[model samples]
Target: MSDKKDPSVWQGFKAFLMRGNVVDLAVAVVVGAAFTNIVNAVVKGMISPVIGAIGTKNLDHYDSCLSATCQGDQGIQIMWGSVLGATLQFLITAAVVYFLMVLPMAKFLARQEARKKAREGTEAAVELTELEVLKEIRDELVARRRSEYGER
Candidate 1:
Protein backbone atom coordinates (compact mmCIF):
# COMPACT_ATOMS: atom_id res chain seq x y z
CA MET A 1 0.00 0.00 0.00
CA SER A 2 1.03 3.62 -0.51
CA ASP A 3 2.32 5.60 2.51
CA LYS A 4 -0.11 8.55 2.05
CA LYS A 5 -2.28 9.42 5.05
CA ASP A 6 -5.85 10.71 4.87
CA PRO A 7 -6.71 14.26 6.00
CA SER A 8 -8.02 14.57 9.55
CA VAL A 9 -11.61 15.65 10.32
CA TRP A 10 -10.35 18.76 12.12
CA GLN A 11 -8.61 19.97 8.95
CA GLY A 12 -11.82 19.56 6.97
CA PHE A 13 -13.82 21.36 9.64
CA LYS A 14 -11.28 24.18 9.77
CA ALA A 15 -11.42 24.61 6.01
CA PHE A 16 -15.20 24.73 6.06
CA LEU A 17 -15.20 27.34 8.81
CA MET A 18 -12.54 29.44 7.06
CA ARG A 19 -14.52 29.71 3.83
CA GLY A 20 -15.59 33.25 2.79
CA ASN A 21 -19.25 32.29 2.25
CA VAL A 22 -19.48 30.64 5.67
CA VAL A 23 -18.19 33.82 7.34
CA ASP A 24 -20.62 35.93 5.37
CA LEU A 25 -23.48 33.60 6.30
CA ALA A 26 -22.50 33.81 9.97
CA VAL A 27 -22.54 37.63 9.83
CA ALA A 28 -25.89 37.63 7.99
CA VAL A 29 -27.41 35.29 10.60
CA VAL A 30 -26.28 37.57 13.44
CA VAL A 31 -27.61 40.67 11.73
CA GLY A 32 -30.87 38.91 10.91
CA ALA A 33 -31.33 37.89 14.53
CA ALA A 34 -30.86 41.50 15.68
CA PHE A 35 -33.14 42.80 12.95
CA THR A 36 -35.81 40.30 13.97
CA ASN A 37 -35.96 41.87 17.42
CA ILE A 38 -36.51 45.31 15.93
CA VAL A 39 -39.23 44.11 13.58
CA ASN A 40 -40.93 42.20 16.36
CA ALA A 41 -40.86 45.27 18.57
CA VAL A 42 -42.45 47.45 15.92
CA VAL A 43 -45.14 44.88 15.22
CA LYS A 44 -45.93 44.30 18.87
CA GLY A 45 -45.63 47.84 20.16
CA MET A 46 -47.03 50.02 17.38
CA ILE A 47 -49.08 47.94 14.97
CA SER A 48 -50.59 45.58 17.49
CA PRO A 49 -51.69 48.35 19.82
CA VAL A 50 -53.21 50.38 17.03
CA ILE A 51 -55.10 47.33 15.80
CA GLY A 52 -56.03 46.32 19.33
CA ALA A 53 -57.70 49.67 19.92
CA ILE A 54 -60.46 48.41 17.66
CA GLY A 55 -60.64 44.99 19.31
CA THR A 56 -58.84 42.79 21.86
CA LYS A 57 -55.26 43.82 22.68
CA ASN A 58 -53.93 40.27 22.26
CA LEU A 59 -54.39 38.78 18.83
CA ASP A 60 -54.06 35.24 20.13
CA HIS A 61 -57.22 35.73 22.14
CA TYR A 62 -59.26 36.45 19.05
CA ASP A 63 -60.59 33.25 17.50
CA SER A 64 -63.80 31.74 16.08
CA CYS A 65 -65.45 28.68 17.54
CA LEU A 66 -66.32 26.29 14.77
CA SER A 67 -67.86 23.66 17.08
CA ALA A 68 -70.71 24.04 19.54
CA THR A 69 -68.61 23.09 22.59
CA CYS A 70 -65.85 25.67 22.12
CA GLN A 71 -65.73 26.65 25.76
CA GLY A 72 -62.43 25.89 27.63
CA ASP A 73 -60.59 24.51 24.58
CA GLN A 74 -63.21 21.87 23.84
CA GLY A 75 -63.99 22.67 20.20
CA ILE A 76 -62.37 23.70 16.91
CA GLN A 77 -61.23 27.31 17.08
CA ILE A 78 -59.83 29.23 14.13
CA MET A 79 -57.33 31.84 15.30
CA TRP A 80 -57.83 34.24 12.41
CA GLY A 81 -56.72 37.31 14.37
CA SER A 82 -53.33 35.74 15.01
CA VAL A 83 -52.97 35.01 11.34
CA LEU A 84 -53.97 38.56 10.47
CA GLY A 85 -51.45 39.92 12.96
CA ALA A 86 -48.70 37.76 11.51
CA THR A 87 -49.62 38.90 7.99
CA LEU A 88 -49.56 42.53 9.04
CA GLN A 89 -46.16 42.09 10.64
CA PHE A 90 -44.85 40.51 7.44
CA LEU A 91 -46.25 43.35 5.32
CA ILE A 92 -44.80 45.98 7.63
CA THR A 93 -41.38 44.34 7.61
CA ALA A 94 -41.46 44.04 3.84
CA ALA A 95 -42.50 47.67 3.43
CA VAL A 96 -39.82 48.86 5.85
CA VAL A 97 -37.07 46.86 4.13
CA TYR A 98 -38.29 47.95 0.70
CA PHE A 99 -38.81 51.65 1.34
CA LEU A 100 -35.84 52.17 3.61
CA MET A 101 -33.20 49.87 2.16
CA VAL A 102 -34.10 48.45 -1.24
CA LEU A 103 -35.64 51.54 -2.76
CA PRO A 104 -32.86 53.88 -1.72
CA MET A 105 -30.18 51.43 -2.80
CA ALA A 106 -31.85 51.03 -6.20
CA LYS A 107 -32.06 54.78 -6.68
CA PHE A 108 -28.43 55.23 -5.71
CA LEU A 109 -27.36 52.45 -8.08
CA ALA A 110 -29.38 54.01 -10.93
CA ARG A 111 -27.75 57.37 -10.35
CA GLN A 112 -24.32 55.75 -10.33
CA GLU A 113 -25.11 53.88 -13.57
CA ALA A 114 -26.28 57.10 -15.22
CA ARG A 115 -23.06 58.86 -14.22
CA LYS A 116 -20.99 55.97 -15.55
CA LYS A 117 -22.87 56.02 -18.86
CA ALA A 118 -22.37 59.77 -19.14
CA ARG A 119 -18.65 59.41 -18.59
CA GLU A 120 -18.44 56.58 -21.12
CA GLY A 121 -20.40 58.62 -23.66
CA THR A 122 -18.12 61.61 -23.27
CA GLU A 123 -14.98 59.41 -23.47
CA ALA A 124 -16.31 57.62 -26.58
CA ALA A 125 -16.92 60.91 -28.39
CA VAL A 126 -13.41 62.14 -27.58
CA GLU A 127 -11.91 58.83 -28.69
CA LEU A 128 -13.86 58.89 -31.95
CA THR A 129 -12.72 62.43 -32.69
CA GLU A 130 -9.12 61.52 -31.86
CA LEU A 131 -9.33 58.49 -34.17
CA GLU A 132 -10.74 60.63 -36.99
CA VAL A 133 -7.89 63.16 -36.58
CA LEU A 134 -5.29 60.36 -36.61
CA LYS A 135 -6.86 58.93 -39.81
CA GLU A 136 -6.84 62.39 -41.44
CA ILE A 137 -3.17 62.87 -40.56
CA ARG A 138 -2.34 59.43 -41.98
CA ASP A 139 -4.24 60.19 -45.20
CA GLU A 140 -2.56 63.60 -45.55
CA LEU A 141 0.91 62.05 -45.02
CA VAL A 142 0.19 59.30 -47.55
CA ALA A 143 -1.08 61.82 -50.12
CA ARG A 144 2.05 63.99 -49.68
CA ARG A 145 4.35 60.98 -49.97
CA ARG A 146 2.54 59.70 -53.12
CA SER A 147 2.71 63.15 -54.79
CA GLU A 148 6.47 63.49 -54.07
CA TYR A 149 7.23 59.92 -55.19
CA GLY A 150 5.01 60.10 -58.27
CA GLU A 151 6.62 63.38 -59.33
CA ARG A 152 10.14 61.79 -59.01
Candidate 2:
Protein backbone atom coordinates (compact mmCIF):
# COMPACT_ATOMS: atom_id res chain seq x y z
CA MET A 1 0.00 0.00 0.00
CA SER A 2 1.14 3.52 -0.72
CA ASP A 3 2.14 5.50 2.42
CA LYS A 4 -0.48 8.09 3.27
CA LYS A 5 -0.85 10.01 6.57
CA ASP A 6 -4.11 9.54 8.42
CA PRO A 7 -6.09 12.75 8.99
CA SER A 8 -7.42 11.25 12.21
CA VAL A 9 -3.96 11.44 13.83
CA TRP A 10 -4.20 15.20 14.21
CA GLN A 11 -7.80 14.89 15.38
CA GLY A 12 -6.74 12.37 18.02
CA PHE A 13 -3.91 14.65 19.16
CA LYS A 14 -6.29 17.58 19.45
CA ALA A 15 -8.73 15.48 21.44
CA PHE A 16 -5.95 14.36 23.77
CA LEU A 17 -4.83 17.95 24.38
CA MET A 18 -8.39 19.03 25.14
CA ARG A 19 -8.89 16.28 27.75
CA GLY A 20 -9.53 17.32 31.37
CA ASN A 21 -6.53 15.48 32.83
CA VAL A 22 -4.02 17.30 30.61
CA VAL A 23 -5.55 20.67 31.44
CA ASP A 24 -5.52 19.88 35.12
CA LEU A 25 -1.87 18.78 34.95
CA ALA A 26 -0.90 22.07 33.26
CA VAL A 27 -2.68 24.05 35.97
CA ALA A 28 -1.09 22.00 38.73
CA VAL A 29 2.40 22.59 37.33
CA VAL A 30 1.87 26.36 37.28
CA VAL A 31 0.37 26.38 40.76
CA GLY A 32 3.08 24.13 42.18
CA ALA A 33 5.81 26.44 40.85
CA ALA A 34 4.09 29.42 42.46
CA PHE A 35 3.65 27.54 45.72
CA THR A 36 7.35 26.56 45.82
CA ASN A 37 8.31 30.23 46.04
CA ILE A 38 5.94 30.70 48.95
CA VAL A 39 7.38 27.68 50.72
CA ASN A 40 10.94 28.93 50.16
CA ALA A 41 10.01 32.32 51.56
CA VAL A 42 8.44 30.77 54.63
CA VAL A 43 11.54 28.70 55.19
CA LYS A 44 13.92 31.65 54.83
CA GLY A 45 11.79 34.15 56.71
CA MET A 46 10.36 32.05 59.54
CA ILE A 47 12.14 28.71 59.95
CA SER A 48 15.76 29.83 59.51
CA PRO A 49 15.79 32.09 62.58
CA VAL A 50 14.32 29.40 64.84
CA ILE A 51 17.03 27.08 63.58
CA GLY A 52 19.60 29.81 64.15
CA ALA A 53 18.48 29.97 67.78
CA ILE A 54 19.54 26.33 68.15
CA GLY A 55 23.09 27.37 67.13
CA THR A 56 23.21 24.71 64.42
CA LYS A 57 21.24 26.74 61.92
CA ASN A 58 24.03 26.90 59.37
CA LEU A 59 25.10 23.35 58.58
CA ASP A 60 27.40 24.50 55.78
CA HIS A 61 30.09 25.82 58.15
CA TYR A 62 31.72 22.50 59.00
CA ASP A 63 35.10 22.30 57.32
CA SER A 64 38.15 20.02 57.32
CA CYS A 65 41.61 21.12 56.18
CA LEU A 66 42.83 19.27 53.10
CA SER A 67 46.42 20.70 52.77
CA ALA A 68 49.51 21.15 54.93
CA THR A 69 49.41 24.86 54.18
CA CYS A 70 45.89 25.11 55.51
CA GLN A 71 45.89 28.68 56.64
CA GLY A 72 42.42 29.97 57.56
CA ASP A 73 42.26 31.80 54.21
CA GLN A 74 43.64 28.93 52.11
CA GLY A 75 41.81 25.92 53.60
CA ILE A 76 39.15 23.90 51.84
CA GLN A 77 35.62 24.93 52.76
CA ILE A 78 32.44 22.87 53.20
CA MET A 79 28.96 24.41 52.97
CA TRP A 80 26.97 21.79 54.87
CA GLY A 81 25.21 24.33 57.05
CA SER A 82 23.22 25.82 54.15
CA VAL A 83 22.40 22.33 52.98
CA LEU A 84 21.10 21.41 56.42
CA GLY A 85 18.93 24.48 56.52
CA ALA A 86 17.47 23.63 53.11
CA THR A 87 16.80 20.06 54.16
CA LEU A 88 15.05 21.15 57.32
CA GLN A 89 12.97 23.63 55.33
CA PHE A 90 11.96 20.88 52.90
CA LEU A 91 10.88 18.65 55.78
CA ILE A 92 8.86 21.44 57.37
CA THR A 93 7.10 22.30 54.11
CA ALA A 94 6.32 18.63 53.47
CA ALA A 95 4.87 18.25 56.96
CA VAL A 96 2.76 21.37 56.56
CA VAL A 97 1.38 20.24 53.19
CA TYR A 98 0.71 16.74 54.45
CA PHE A 99 -1.12 17.90 57.57
CA LEU A 100 -2.76 21.09 56.32
CA MET A 101 -3.63 20.26 52.70
CA VAL A 102 -3.25 16.65 51.60
CA LEU A 103 -4.68 14.87 54.63
CA PRO A 104 -7.84 16.92 54.92
CA MET A 105 -8.48 16.94 51.17
CA ALA A 106 -8.05 13.18 50.99
CA LYS A 107 -10.49 12.65 53.85
CA PHE A 108 -13.05 15.04 52.41
CA LEU A 109 -12.87 13.45 48.94
CA ALA A 110 -13.20 9.96 50.44
CA ARG A 111 -16.33 10.96 52.33
CA GLN A 112 -17.81 12.60 49.26
CA GLU A 113 -17.11 9.50 47.16
CA ALA A 114 -18.67 7.26 49.80
CA ARG A 115 -21.80 9.40 49.92
CA LYS A 116 -22.07 9.33 46.12
CA LYS A 117 -21.73 5.55 46.06
CA ALA A 118 -24.39 5.19 48.75
CA ARG A 119 -26.78 7.37 46.76
CA GLU A 120 -26.19 5.31 43.63
CA GLY A 121 -26.75 2.06 45.57
CA THR A 122 -30.02 3.38 46.98
CA GLU A 123 -31.25 4.38 43.53
CA ALA A 124 -30.28 1.02 42.05
CA ALA A 125 -32.07 -0.83 44.84
CA VAL A 126 -35.25 1.18 44.26
CA GLU A 127 -35.21 0.70 40.49
CA LEU A 128 -35.87 -3.10 40.27
CA THR A 129 -36.04 -6.17 42.48
CA GLU A 130 -35.15 -9.58 40.89
CA LEU A 131 -38.72 -10.81 41.31
CA GLU A 132 -40.18 -7.73 39.66
CA VAL A 133 -37.83 -8.07 36.65
CA LEU A 134 -38.73 -11.78 36.32
CA LYS A 135 -42.42 -10.90 36.48
CA GLU A 136 -41.98 -8.34 33.71
CA ILE A 137 -40.24 -10.88 31.48
CA ARG A 138 -42.90 -13.51 32.19
CA ASP A 139 -45.70 -11.05 31.33
CA GLU A 140 -44.01 -10.15 28.05
CA LEU A 141 -43.79 -13.84 27.03
CA VAL A 142 -47.39 -14.48 27.98
CA ALA A 143 -48.55 -11.51 25.89
CA ARG A 144 -46.48 -12.70 22.97
CA ARG A 145 -47.98 -16.23 23.15
CA ARG A 146 -51.55 -14.85 23.33
CA SER A 147 -50.91 -12.59 20.35
CA GLU A 148 -49.52 -15.49 18.27
CA TYR A 149 -52.65 -17.56 18.92
CA GLY A 150 -55.05 -14.60 18.37
CA GLU A 151 -56.45 -15.11 21.91
CA ARG A 152 -58.43 -12.46 23.91
Candidate 3:
Protein backbone atom coordinates (compact mmCIF):
# COMPACT_ATOMS: atom_id res chain seq x y z
CA MET A 1 0.00 0.00 0.00
CA SER A 2 1.05 3.64 -0.69
CA ASP A 3 2.15 5.77 2.30
CA LYS A 4 0.52 9.04 1.23
CA LYS A 5 -2.72 10.06 3.03
CA ASP A 6 -5.67 11.72 1.26
CA PRO A 7 -6.16 15.51 1.79
CA SER A 8 -8.62 16.31 4.59
CA VAL A 9 -11.35 18.97 4.53
CA TRP A 10 -9.77 20.72 7.52
CA GLN A 11 -6.48 21.00 5.62
CA GLY A 12 -8.23 22.68 2.68
CA PHE A 13 -9.98 25.08 5.06
CA LYS A 14 -6.67 25.94 6.71
CA ALA A 15 -5.09 26.61 3.35
CA PHE A 16 -7.97 28.97 2.41
CA LEU A 17 -7.53 30.91 5.66
CA MET A 18 -3.76 31.20 5.07
CA ARG A 19 -4.25 32.92 1.68
CA GLY A 20 -3.28 36.62 1.44
CA ASN A 21 -6.76 37.73 0.27
CA VAL A 22 -8.45 36.15 3.32
CA VAL A 23 -6.05 37.93 5.70
CA ASP A 24 -6.49 41.22 3.86
CA LEU A 25 -10.28 40.81 3.98
CA ALA A 26 -10.14 40.18 7.75
CA VAL A 27 -8.07 43.35 8.26
CA ALA A 28 -10.42 45.36 6.02
CA VAL A 29 -13.46 44.25 8.08
CA VAL A 30 -11.78 45.31 11.34
CA VAL A 31 -10.67 48.69 9.94
CA GLY A 32 -14.12 49.27 8.41
CA ALA A 33 -15.80 48.73 11.81
CA ALA A 34 -13.41 51.26 13.42
CA PHE A 35 -13.92 53.72 10.55
CA THR A 36 -17.73 53.42 10.98
CA ASN A 37 -17.47 54.84 14.51
CA ILE A 38 -15.52 57.89 13.30
CA VAL A 39 -17.99 58.55 10.49
CA ASN A 40 -20.99 58.19 12.81
CA ALA A 41 -19.36 60.56 15.33
CA VAL A 42 -18.73 63.18 12.64
CA VAL A 43 -22.34 62.92 11.37
CA LYS A 44 -23.82 63.14 14.87
CA GLY A 45 -21.51 65.77 16.40
CA MET A 46 -20.98 68.15 13.48
CA ILE A 47 -23.34 67.61 10.53
CA SER A 48 -26.47 66.95 12.61
CA PRO A 49 -25.99 70.19 14.57
CA VAL A 50 -25.71 72.17 11.34
CA ILE A 51 -28.96 70.62 10.09
CA GLY A 52 -30.56 71.18 13.52
CA ALA A 53 -29.98 74.93 13.16
CA ILE A 54 -32.64 74.91 10.44
CA GLY A 55 -35.34 73.11 12.47
CA THR A 56 -35.35 70.10 14.85
CA LYS A 57 -32.19 68.96 16.63
CA ASN A 58 -33.16 65.27 16.58
CA LEU A 59 -33.89 63.92 13.09
CA ASP A 60 -35.82 60.88 14.43
CA HIS A 61 -38.48 63.24 15.87
CA TYR A 62 -38.99 64.94 12.50
CA ASP A 63 -41.71 62.72 11.03
CA SER A 64 -44.97 63.44 9.18
CA CYS A 65 -48.29 61.81 10.15
CA LEU A 66 -50.30 60.39 7.26
CA SER A 67 -53.52 59.41 9.09
CA ALA A 68 -56.37 61.83 9.91
CA THR A 69 -56.47 61.05 13.67
CA CYS A 70 -52.72 60.94 14.07
CA GLN A 71 -51.22 61.33 17.55
CA GLY A 72 -47.95 60.04 18.96
CA ASP A 73 -47.32 56.49 17.58
CA GLN A 74 -50.93 55.98 16.35
CA GLY A 75 -50.33 56.96 12.74
CA ILE A 76 -48.66 55.99 9.48
CA GLN A 77 -45.58 58.19 9.66
CA ILE A 78 -43.01 59.09 7.02
CA MET A 79 -39.62 59.49 8.67
CA TRP A 80 -37.90 61.39 5.89
CA GLY A 81 -35.51 63.29 8.19
CA SER A 82 -34.04 60.02 9.57
CA VAL A 83 -33.59 58.73 6.04
CA LEU A 84 -31.89 62.01 5.07
CA GLY A 85 -29.56 61.78 8.07
CA ALA A 86 -28.62 58.16 7.25
CA THR A 87 -28.02 59.11 3.59
CA LEU A 88 -25.76 61.93 4.68
CA GLN A 89 -23.79 59.55 6.92
CA PHE A 90 -23.30 57.09 4.04
CA LEU A 91 -22.16 59.86 1.64
CA ILE A 92 -19.67 61.31 4.15
CA THR A 93 -18.19 57.87 4.91
CA ALA A 94 -17.81 57.02 1.21
CA ALA A 95 -16.23 60.40 0.37
CA VAL A 96 -13.75 60.26 3.26
CA VAL A 97 -12.72 56.65 2.55
CA TYR A 98 -12.30 57.35 -1.19
CA PHE A 99 -10.37 60.63 -0.84
CA LEU A 100 -8.26 59.74 2.22
CA MET A 101 -7.49 56.08 1.49
CA VAL A 102 -8.40 54.62 -1.92
CA LEU A 103 -7.39 57.51 -4.19
CA PRO A 104 -3.95 58.06 -2.61
CA MET A 105 -3.17 54.33 -2.61
CA ALA A 106 -4.15 54.10 -6.31
CA LYS A 107 -1.82 57.00 -7.21
CA PHE A 108 1.04 55.48 -5.22
CA LEU A 109 0.57 52.08 -6.91
CA ALA A 110 0.49 53.76 -10.33
CA ARG A 111 3.81 55.51 -9.61
CA GLN A 112 5.40 52.26 -8.48
CA GLU A 113 4.16 50.47 -11.64
CA ALA A 114 5.58 53.26 -13.84
CA ARG A 115 8.97 52.99 -12.13
CA LYS A 116 8.98 49.20 -12.61
CA LYS A 117 8.17 49.56 -16.33
CA ALA A 118 10.95 52.15 -16.79
CA ARG A 119 13.54 49.83 -15.22
CA GLU A 120 12.41 46.92 -17.45
CA GLY A 121 12.62 49.18 -20.56
CA THR A 122 16.17 50.24 -19.66
CA GLU A 123 17.22 46.59 -19.21
CA ALA A 124 15.62 45.65 -22.54
CA ALA A 125 17.44 48.51 -24.31
CA VAL A 126 20.80 47.33 -22.91
CA GLU A 127 20.07 43.72 -24.00
CA LEU A 128 19.13 44.93 -27.53
CA THR A 129 22.42 46.90 -27.85
CA GLU A 130 24.41 43.86 -26.73
CA LEU A 131 22.61 41.63 -29.27
CA GLU A 132 23.33 44.15 -32.08
CA VAL A 133 27.06 44.28 -31.14
CA LEU A 134 27.26 40.44 -31.12
CA LYS A 135 25.61 40.27 -34.54
CA GLU A 136 28.15 42.81 -35.96
CA ILE A 137 31.06 40.84 -34.55
CA ARG A 138 29.65 37.59 -36.05
CA ASP A 139 29.25 39.28 -39.51
CA GLU A 140 32.86 40.63 -39.40
CA LEU A 141 34.23 37.15 -38.50
CA VAL A 142 32.27 35.52 -41.37
CA ALA A 143 33.55 38.12 -43.88
CA ARG A 144 37.20 37.60 -42.80
CA ARG A 145 36.85 33.76 -43.07
CA ARG A 146 35.29 34.08 -46.54
CA SER A 147 38.10 36.42 -47.79
CA GLU A 148 40.87 34.07 -46.50
CA TYR A 149 39.19 31.01 -48.13
CA GLY A 150 38.72 32.90 -51.45
CA GLU A 151 42.44 33.97 -51.51
CA ARG A 152 43.58 30.37 -50.83
Candidate 4:
Protein backbone atom coordinates (compact mmCIF):
# COMPACT_ATOMS: atom_id res chain seq x y z
CA MET A 1 0.00 0.00 0.00
CA SER A 2 2.82 2.37 0.81
CA ASP A 3 4.53 1.51 -2.47
CA LYS A 4 1.23 2.00 -4.28
CA LYS A 5 0.64 5.47 -2.84
CA ASP A 6 -0.44 7.77 -5.66
CA PRO A 7 2.29 9.43 -7.71
CA SER A 8 -0.29 11.84 -9.17
CA VAL A 9 0.73 14.79 -6.96
CA TRP A 10 4.36 14.60 -8.04
CA GLN A 11 3.34 13.96 -11.64
CA GLY A 12 1.04 17.01 -11.59
CA PHE A 13 3.80 19.21 -10.20
CA LYS A 14 6.16 18.03 -12.92
CA ALA A 15 3.52 18.70 -15.56
CA PHE A 16 2.92 22.22 -14.18
CA LEU A 17 6.61 23.09 -14.38
CA MET A 18 6.87 21.70 -17.90
CA ARG A 19 3.94 23.77 -19.19
CA GLY A 20 4.65 26.67 -21.56
CA ASN A 21 2.87 29.20 -19.31
CA VAL A 22 5.09 28.40 -16.35
CA VAL A 23 8.24 28.48 -18.50
CA ASP A 24 7.17 31.79 -20.01
CA LEU A 25 6.60 33.21 -16.52
CA ALA A 26 10.09 32.14 -15.45
CA VAL A 27 11.60 33.74 -18.56
CA ALA A 28 9.62 36.93 -17.97
CA VAL A 29 10.96 37.20 -14.42
CA VAL A 30 14.57 37.00 -15.64
CA VAL A 31 13.94 39.43 -18.49
CA GLY A 32 12.07 41.80 -16.19
CA ALA A 33 15.02 41.96 -13.79
CA ALA A 34 17.32 42.85 -16.69
CA PHE A 35 14.84 45.42 -18.01
CA THR A 36 14.53 46.94 -14.53
CA ASN A 37 18.21 47.90 -14.62
CA ILE A 38 17.68 49.72 -17.92
CA VAL A 39 14.57 51.51 -16.68
CA ASN A 40 16.32 52.54 -13.43
CA ALA A 41 19.19 53.96 -15.44
CA VAL A 42 16.86 55.99 -17.63
CA VAL A 43 14.93 57.41 -14.66
CA LYS A 44 18.00 58.23 -12.57
CA GLY A 45 20.06 59.54 -15.44
CA MET A 46 17.40 61.70 -17.12
CA ILE A 47 14.24 62.24 -15.08
CA SER A 48 15.91 62.77 -11.69
CA PRO A 49 18.04 65.67 -12.84
CA VAL A 50 15.12 67.33 -14.55
CA ILE A 51 13.03 67.02 -11.38
CA GLY A 52 15.97 68.14 -9.23
CA ALA A 53 16.53 71.19 -11.42
CA ILE A 54 12.92 72.21 -10.91
CA GLY A 55 12.86 71.48 -7.14
CA THR A 56 15.52 70.85 -4.48
CA LYS A 57 19.18 69.89 -5.00
CA ASN A 58 18.36 66.14 -4.66
CA LEU A 59 15.07 64.54 -5.59
CA ASP A 60 15.65 61.48 -3.42
CA HIS A 61 16.61 63.30 -0.20
CA TYR A 62 13.87 64.54 2.09
CA ASP A 63 14.18 65.31 5.84
CA SER A 64 11.57 65.78 8.57
CA CYS A 65 12.36 67.16 12.02
CA LEU A 66 10.47 65.82 15.06
CA SER A 67 8.89 68.33 17.49
CA ALA A 68 11.44 69.84 19.98
CA THR A 69 14.07 67.13 19.71
CA CYS A 70 17.45 67.63 21.39
CA GLN A 71 20.12 69.26 19.21
CA GLY A 72 22.00 65.96 18.82
CA ASP A 73 18.76 64.00 18.38
CA GLN A 74 17.32 66.26 15.66
CA GLY A 75 15.62 64.10 13.03
CA ILE A 76 17.64 64.05 9.85
CA GLN A 77 15.97 61.56 7.55
CA ILE A 78 17.01 60.46 4.10
CA MET A 79 13.68 59.49 2.54
CA TRP A 80 14.42 57.30 -0.51
CA GLY A 81 14.31 59.58 -3.57
CA SER A 82 15.97 56.86 -5.57
CA VAL A 83 13.24 54.44 -4.54
CA LEU A 84 10.61 56.93 -5.72
CA GLY A 85 12.50 57.19 -8.99
CA ALA A 86 12.61 53.42 -9.22
CA THR A 87 8.85 53.21 -8.65
CA LEU A 88 8.29 55.58 -11.57
CA GLN A 89 10.66 53.53 -13.67
CA PHE A 90 8.73 50.35 -12.88
CA LEU A 91 5.44 52.00 -13.89
CA ILE A 92 6.89 53.10 -17.23
CA THR A 93 8.29 49.62 -17.82
CA ALA A 94 4.90 48.02 -17.11
CA ALA A 95 3.14 50.40 -19.47
CA VAL A 96 5.67 49.78 -22.24
CA VAL A 97 5.46 46.01 -21.84
CA TYR A 98 1.65 46.02 -21.86
CA PHE A 99 1.29 48.22 -24.93
CA LEU A 100 4.36 47.19 -26.93
CA MET A 101 4.65 43.49 -26.11
CA VAL A 102 1.49 42.04 -24.60
CA LEU A 103 -1.21 43.84 -26.57
CA PRO A 104 0.41 43.37 -29.99
CA MET A 105 1.30 39.75 -29.34
CA ALA A 106 -2.25 38.94 -28.17
CA LYS A 107 -3.78 40.63 -31.21
CA PHE A 108 -1.41 38.86 -33.59
CA LEU A 109 -2.10 35.47 -32.04
CA ALA A 110 -5.86 36.05 -32.11
CA ARG A 111 -5.75 37.01 -35.80
CA GLN A 112 -3.65 33.94 -36.61
CA GLU A 113 -6.07 31.66 -34.73
CA ALA A 114 -9.07 33.22 -36.45
CA ARG A 115 -7.45 32.77 -39.86
CA LYS A 116 -6.68 29.13 -39.13
CA LYS A 117 -10.28 28.45 -38.07
CA ALA A 118 -11.60 30.21 -41.17
CA ARG A 119 -9.34 28.13 -43.41
CA GLU A 120 -10.51 24.92 -41.76
CA GLY A 121 -14.16 25.95 -42.14
CA THR A 122 -13.62 26.78 -45.81
CA GLU A 123 -12.01 23.40 -46.44
CA ALA A 124 -14.94 21.64 -44.77
CA ALA A 125 -17.47 23.67 -46.80
CA VAL A 126 -15.71 22.81 -50.06
CA GLU A 127 -17.23 19.33 -49.97
CA LEU A 128 -20.76 20.72 -50.56
CA THR A 129 -21.32 22.87 -53.66
CA GLU A 130 -24.49 24.70 -54.90
CA LEU A 131 -24.54 22.56 -58.05
CA GLU A 132 -24.39 19.33 -56.05
CA VAL A 133 -27.19 20.54 -53.77
CA LEU A 134 -29.35 21.46 -56.80
CA LYS A 135 -28.73 17.98 -58.32
CA GLU A 136 -29.75 16.26 -55.08
CA ILE A 137 -33.00 18.24 -54.98
CA ARG A 138 -33.76 17.41 -58.64
CA ASP A 139 -33.12 13.67 -58.04
CA GLU A 140 -35.45 13.68 -55.00
CA LEU A 141 -38.21 15.41 -56.96
CA VAL A 142 -37.89 12.89 -59.86
CA ALA A 143 -38.11 9.93 -57.45
CA ARG A 144 -41.15 11.40 -55.70
CA ARG A 145 -42.93 11.94 -59.07
CA ARG A 146 -42.16 8.34 -60.20
CA SER A 147 -43.41 6.93 -56.91
CA GLU A 148 -46.65 8.94 -57.23
CA TYR A 149 -47.26 7.68 -60.75
CA GLY A 150 -46.56 4.09 -59.69
CA GLU A 151 -49.03 4.42 -56.83
CA ARG A 152 -51.71 5.62 -59.31
Count of backbone clashes, every candidate in sequence: 0, 7, 0, 1
- Ten residues in sequence with the least summed lDDT for candidate 3: 1-10
TM-score of 4: 0.63
TM-score per prediction, in order, is: 0.84, 0.62, 0.89, 0.63
Flag clash pairs in model 2: 58-81, 59-80, 59-81, 60-79, 60-80, 60-81, 60-82
Ranking by TM-score: 3, 1, 4, 2
Model 4 residue runs over 4 Å out of place are 1-16, 56-58, 63-73, 76-83, 120-152
Query: What is candidate 1's CA lDDT for residue 135?
Result: 100
Clashing pairs in 4: 60-81
Q: Model 3 misses residue 9 by how many Å?
A: 2.8
Once fitted onto the true fold, the runs of candidate 3 whose alpha carbons sit more than 4 angstroms away are 1-7
Q: What is the lDDT of residue 72 in candidate 4?
A: 51
lDDT of each: 0.88, 0.79, 0.91, 0.79
lDDT of 2: 0.79
Specify the poorest-scoring 10-residue window by lDDT in model 2: 1-10
Residue by residue across 69-146, what tens digits does model 1's lDDT show?
A: 788858999999889888887888789888987999999999999999999999999999999999999999999999
The top-ranked prediction according to lDDT is: 3
Candidate 3's residue-wise lDDT over 1-152, tens digit each?
13343356667888999999999999999999999999999988998888899987778878788888668778798998899888998999999999999999999999999999999999999999999999999999999999999999
Query: Cα RMSD to native, each candidate?
Result: 2.9, 6.2, 3.1, 4.5
What would the TM-score be for candidate 1 when compared with the true structure?
0.84
lDDT by residue for model 2 over 95-122, one digit each (tens)? Answer: 8789988999999999999999999988
| Reference-based lDDT, residue 138, model 2 | 100
